[model samples]
Target: MPITLHDAFVPTAQQILRAVRGLVDKAERHCAENGVADSELIEARLADDMWPLPWHVRSCWVHSGYAINRFKTGVFTPDFTDIPDDWDAMRDQIDDALTQLDAITPDTLEELAPQTVGFELGGQRLMEMTGQNFLLSFTQPNLFFSCLHIL
Candidate 1:
């Protein structure tokens, strides 16, 4: 049988999920190497416009984490956005994210919701669940690279 668009789309989408995980891992390491143990750095403030780039980058990581839980039928909702307030557990969370995304299949993607508050994307009101989910997956890389550091 010929492949449907989804057959191609899911793997490509998985690569983005994987890349996001990679960058987040890189960022976490960068943070650790430069950090002063269990302390926080002032957030970056380079952007001069609304929806700053760091927000975009961090949201991709956060949303990717959210996507994983929603993707699995028999999994717990991980506290993706929870600041560990500690170092080791934080690194463990990053590792856990990579493991989760590596496990996704089309059957898994079909289980996720976009976690959106708005009614549309690009001014086109979405009518189906799968459409928006895949759309989010498509744009995830856009969000990730817009602020990710070289790593």
Candidate 2:
């Protein structure tokens, strides 16, 4: 059978989102067991210049579920707002992403596959590609990167 755009994107995104959700749960448990405050874990970063745990968790949503929704608009832009600052909020963000992913029908993504999607950041056009390419090449990698940081 031929691989549809939906085949390539939605299931993978859903799986990654679920993994992120699990990681958030485990992190909460670890913090509680270790007597580490949620704030400390949320604010932790792998490096001095990198974003904290909450940002990485939020980015998973932004690059997966949020990116899929934005494809309908023919442009892709990274959202940096409303990043969760606590453990519960991080889990909530993941849950919201899962909910959004669940609402996406295969037909919607299939229809968008061949459509043009411009990627813009900081008011500059980074690149323009088909929706399929944007999702597979750009957003999926970004989702994985964010998830890796949380792990």
Candidate 3:
């Protein structure tokens, strides 16, 4: 069978988000077992120039469920504000993303596939493409990148 836009995006995004949730649980367990504070892991980063753990987690949500919602608006803008700095909040973010994904039916994505979505940053339009392309080419990659960093 030919793949639909929903088949290509929603399930894949949800799987990645679920994996992220599992990793978060493991990190919390590891921290607890090692006598390390949860905040230490929350604030930790692989490099000085990169955002901390919370940002990666937040990005997963932003690039997946949040990005889907933005497709309806015909513009995609990266939101970097209000990243959660605590464990509970981080989990909540993931949970919220999962919930959002669950609400998106296949017909929703099919209807959006041909619509134009602009990629904007800092009041500038960086690119424009069909919603399908925006999701598969851009949002999906960013979602994976964020999930990888979280690992």
Number of the top candidate by lDDT?
A: 3
Q: By TM-score, how accurate is candidate 3?
A: 0.97
lDDT digits (tens) for residues 1-151 of candidate 2: 8988888888888898888888888889989999988778778899999999989988998998899889899999989899998778888989889888889888898989999999999999899999889999989999999989988
lDDT of 3 by residue, 95-124 (tens): 999999999999999999999999999999
Output the TM-score of candidate 1: 0.43
lDDT for predicted candidate 1 compared with the true structure: 0.44
lDDT against the true structure, per candidate, is 0.44, 0.89, 0.92
Pick the TM-score winner: 3
Clashes of each: 0, 0, 0
Flag regions of model 2 displaced more than 4 Å. none
Pairs in clash, predicted candidate 1: none
Which 10-residue span in candidate 2 carries the lowest summed lDDT?
Answer: 36-45
Compared with the true structure, model 2 gives a TM-score of 0.95
Give the residue spans of candidate 1 off by over 4 A.
1-42, 48-58, 71-81, 84-90, 110-128, 131-151
Rank by TM-score, descending? Answer: 3, 2, 1
Q: Candidate 3 at 114: error in angstroms?
A: 1.0
